[model samples]
Target chain A: MNEKLDITLTVNGRSHALGVEPRRNLADALRDDLGLTGTHVGCEHGVCGACTVLMDGRPVRSCLTFACQAEGAAIETVEGLADGDRLHPLQQKFWELHGLQCGFCTPGMLMLAAGALRENPDMDDEEIREVMSSNLCRCTGYQNILRAVRAAADVMRAEGAQG
Target chain B: MKPASFSYHKPGSVSAALALLAQFGEEGKIIAGGQSLVPSMNFRLARPETLIDINHIAEIQGVSDQGDHLEIGAVTRHATFHHPVSPCPLGRMLTKVVANIAHYPIRQRGTFGGSLSHADPASEWCLVAVTMGAEMEIHGPAGARRVPAAQFFRGTFTTAVGRDELLARIRLPKLPEGWGTGFYEFSRRKGDFALAMALAALKVEGGTIRAARLGLGAVGAHPQRLEALEAELTGQPATPQTFAAIGARAQTMVTPSGDIHGSAEYRRELAATVIARALTRAAEDAA
Candidate 1:
């Protein structure tokens, strides 16, 4: 009943060409079509940022964006944060700071914080909290999550200065 | 929830998009940022037969300076206002207002035109458009025409732009030199729907108000300019006492309905409070 269109989406440095229905959102395609299930769907609306991913280095709600509309766009999901064995600084900080309780909103939080940290490496605690406010976390009460983002930002800034 | 089945058409140019809109008429819906429309589609509230994706039309993207006025393309992202594509007076006002939107991620995708065309009374863009006296550039079968922001918004989720016409761009005139402006909104949470909002701009000279533009949002079916209050402010002394009196008088000037957010009486009270704060801040900025 739905028309299918061809699209090529580059996610986490890997390009995948697939066909999706016109109504298929980018979040569903990233999870169902590609097997990268890190991107979660909470509200399925733009209000909640659970399905957020980096598009061209900027955070965007994948649930609201159509997969076909994302053709030729560079996307980054939670799965892209870690290497084979070494975890990204954000993941390490989250683990150390106890940023996750149920871990449902972690993927989206990590992706958004990654984008935020990249844009503002010297971001303060208030800035980190402000950016993470969109993604809802029922478990952590957001205190630890803010700490994790702040710690990760410091590490990222130091690494950037060195390299 | 997933949106219903629909045919998607991605047009490369404005003419091609207009052609499809004319062909489909009411059966088609243009998708720009998709931040608002996609969610509505998922809820089955808005189900158009044809989804015309206009993300690739480069002609209606980015900012252009028109000497006296700055023309902002409809597809320009809200995040672009944070550090504007180009610096202008409008950016200073937009940065304050855009932060009140959903979040950083949503701001990255939501477009200036999409929000204006949506015409949500609570939207920051709609309120500011009315405050700035923006002119909307529309394109259709008959070619192009400009509609003032005052006339562009007809009602809640309604605009003067026809189904066959597209809101291509919006032109915001540069505020007079030394003009000070303020935008304030009250939402339950940081990104929630606003209950009451106000935008104020003041151009004061020799301790007297030369021009005062004030607008209110989320207090009615559409955002409206406070013409009576604005007239009262003009030629008046730029003093906090005068602004406070005008703000208190503004409560009686609006007609707002009660909803889940707050009571009608409560919103009226807030209208006075926000308007007063906005006016005082704008006056301070002018000095």
Candidate 2:
């Protein structure tokens, strides 16, 4: 039997030590070993952002990143977006705007959008399109997705102002 | 599709990485970010027996500004160059282009050295690296060597890199005070590979052109530096007429090949237009 390599990773503020092959992708490792399937796999070629996850606060395609490459790295999958049962603002906007149809691309889109919003909370429509262009959703024509991002931005801003 | 089985080694130091390269030779491949290599491996386009992962090598990551030149580690992420606070406008522009490359997720995992080593003629980073006259520092079993941008790239998907060598850092000389730069590319979509691209850098003195450097990509086997056009611009007055003449000279400098997105003649014409536009913008910036 091929010896499994030891890997230590921090996911969603929790640390885990696992044994796996060096060739295992972060997306596969998250879904199969850790049982966090929120990070979807689409196009596998980095063209599609279905497997997007936050690595040290930056969104990266988990499908293209080797698990060995992510050793000792801090990762946040879609499962970490919400605080317990309380939904993230982006998730609320996604739900309110019907930003998804099949929901396969939702988790990735939500993560990317959340990252973008955190970086630029006041992002306008064109800016949202420019940033969201990376993620592809064949089910949605991208109009509602754009609306969801804008709606979420507004919610984030309103919450900030209220506080 | 899963990547073919391969042994992986994580070297902690640059010297250790080079030693691994020497031990494995052509049977090994270096993985940084793994944006391009992983996909290629899964497709069976390239399958090596050993994979030397260099992400943990501390000496081969980050950016260093040494007064006269900027030393960029090979493993520096593309996002580092794109940050808004970048000292060099050229560096900032590269970051913006890289941000739009594929998508944010890909850029997060892609390294500047990986992109340059990939040497895709259509890649914007390769064209910019050539235009800026960047020098690549390489370490191998034979010791360390530096190759100037002009000689670094050999051909499409090829460079001066050897099997037992790893690119360690990229050295870019600080631009002269009057130097102005511009980069432009036309793609099918926002994040698609460039159909045609142009980059121009020029130094102007009192309305006269002191020096000029121009480069074009995706139109040839390798990115071409417009020496002929640059020669015509030197010592001439920096004006619309001078730019027009340089554009005319650029038309004959490259013979773009036809591709799925555009025809040969169309790319040639687009090259001329982009060159003119880039030169004009760069000249304005210098002024």
Candidate 3:
């Protein structure tokens, strides 16, 4: 048997230091060990974005990454998008647009879209679709998801100008 | 499924990493970003006993402009190449193709060297490196040696990197003025694996073709340069008709295998379409 490894990670502004096996993935660590189950695990093979999370502010498939690989890295899961029960603009837009159906892919979709909006605040519909195409949501045909991103972009821009 | 058990080491320096590789021999696998290797391990496709993680090795980190060539570190993330502050048009082209790879999440963890070392023929970085005449530097106990892209890739998921060697950096020659470039790929869906892809770089001088480099992917064991079509285009008049004629000639140069997404005949037709579209885009970029 292999020895347990020491890992330190910061998720949603909190630090965690734990002993993990060498084979444990970041998604498993988030859901099983850390009890941050907002980041789902659909296809452990990376084909599904249900395991997406933000590593140092950039979206990455947590299922395909080893927990030790993220040591000293800052992470953000779906649970980090809220501020004391107040939802993010993207979360509100997703709720208003009915962007989710079965809700299995929502956590990953929200994280991916939030990262895209941060990188490009003025992305159009076609651009949003092209960027979000990497994240697969079987229930929603993706039309409403595209609309939600567009609507959220306006809300984020307005909030930015006001501040 | 969980990955097989393995020992992990993250060395802080390149020399220490190379020393670790030399000590571990065939039991070691160097991991850059773990975008490809981690999934393979999880699926039990690859079972290396020891993983030499090189992500913390600072020597192989960023892009450097060296006047005649751009020296890109092996560990440079795909996101860095896509940023607006990148120096070359090739960086912008890479950014566009990288965005279409898997998704933003995968790109954030995928390193330039990881893609090259993975050696997937359908991968964007492999095709672009072969087309642009990039050079790879490998370090071992004997020190560093440079291998040209033309001689680097051995076959599907295979490279010339030896067991004791580590890919250090990739050097890409800067594009000369008046050079046009294009990259086109046809896939069943956007962000899916490519069925067929083509890359073209042409240097047109005063309406005449001074030089041309054409590369085709997903049609062979390794991405290949179309030397026959390149020879035919040199010194010829640059025109839409000439490009179409060359595209037809290029169709015969490669024989792609039949797969689930596309038939062999369909892929042949797509080769022509991709090449023609790439040439037109390249010409427009040059103009």
Proportion of true inter-chain contacts also present in candidate 1:
0.85
Docking class of 2: medium
DockQ of each: 0.83, 0.65, 0.78
Clashing pairs in 3: none
lDDT of 3 at B150: 95
lDDT of 2 by residue, B99-147 (tens): 5455666777788898889888887778878877899998877789999
Which candidate leads the pack in lDDT?
Answer: 1
> Native-contact recovery for every candidate?
0.85, 0.61, 0.80
Q: Which residue runs does candidate 2 get wrong by more than 4 Å?
A: A160-163, B84-100, B205-208, B235-241
Predicted candidate 3 versus true structure: per-residue lDDT over B3-68, tens digit per residue? 899988889988998889989898999999888898899889999999999999889998988877
Model 1 regions more than 4 Å off: B84-88
Docking class of 3: medium
Residue range B1-287, candidate 1, lDDT tens digits? 88889999999999999999989888999999988999999998999999998899999999887878888899998888876443555667777788887788988889999999998889989998888889999999999998999999899999999979999999988776788888888888888888998999998999999999999998998888898889999999998789789878998998888987788999999998889888888888788
Interface RMSD for each candidate model?
1.1, 1.8, 1.3
TM-score of chain A of 1: 0.97
Q: Give the Cα-based TM-score of candidate 1 against the true structure.
A: 0.97
